[model samples]
Target: MSSPRKTSPGKRMTAGLLVMAGLLLVREFAPESPIAIAALIIGLIALLIIIPAYFRALLSSRRDR
Candidate 1:
């Protein structure tokens, strides 16, 4: 049997996606609410943060091999 490996970036990206989905649902119910806008902004920020972090990890791992 083989153990499965975990990835931090993958998890972060998945979390970002889930947050965005939740924000979309909120927007559908209350499009003009401040809370919906706030949730959207936070979700975008989380998604943006993951991009560079993922690339950096990929580049560093390549250099090691």
Candidate 2:
């Protein structure tokens, strides 16, 4: 059996912010389009995943130190 690799908290947060920026840009540039709504939904999902993953990594790293 092999253990899964850990992801860096910083990376997750960076990705989340980037997704948010992309979503915002899409919405700003094309508010009447369907893609903007899709971006918003995807961005929210990315944020939901990122926040918890980032915290989990942060706490575990602290615990190990």
Q: Highest TM-score among the candidates is held by which one?
A: 2
Model 1: what TM-score? 0.59
Candidate 1 — worst ten consecutive residues by lDDT sum? 6-15
TM-scores across all candidates? Answer: 0.59, 0.73
**Per-residue lDDT for 1-65 in model 2, tens only?**
99998767777888888888889999999999999889989988988978897888789889999
Can you write out model 1's per-residue Cα lDDT over 1-65, one digit (the tens) per residue? 99998666657666767777887888889888898889778877977967766776688678879
- RMSD (Cα, Å) of model 1: 4.8
- Candidate 1, residue 6: CA error in Å? 9.5
Runs in model 1 lying further than 4 Å from the true structure:
1-7, 53-65
Residue 62 error, candidate 1, Å = 6.7
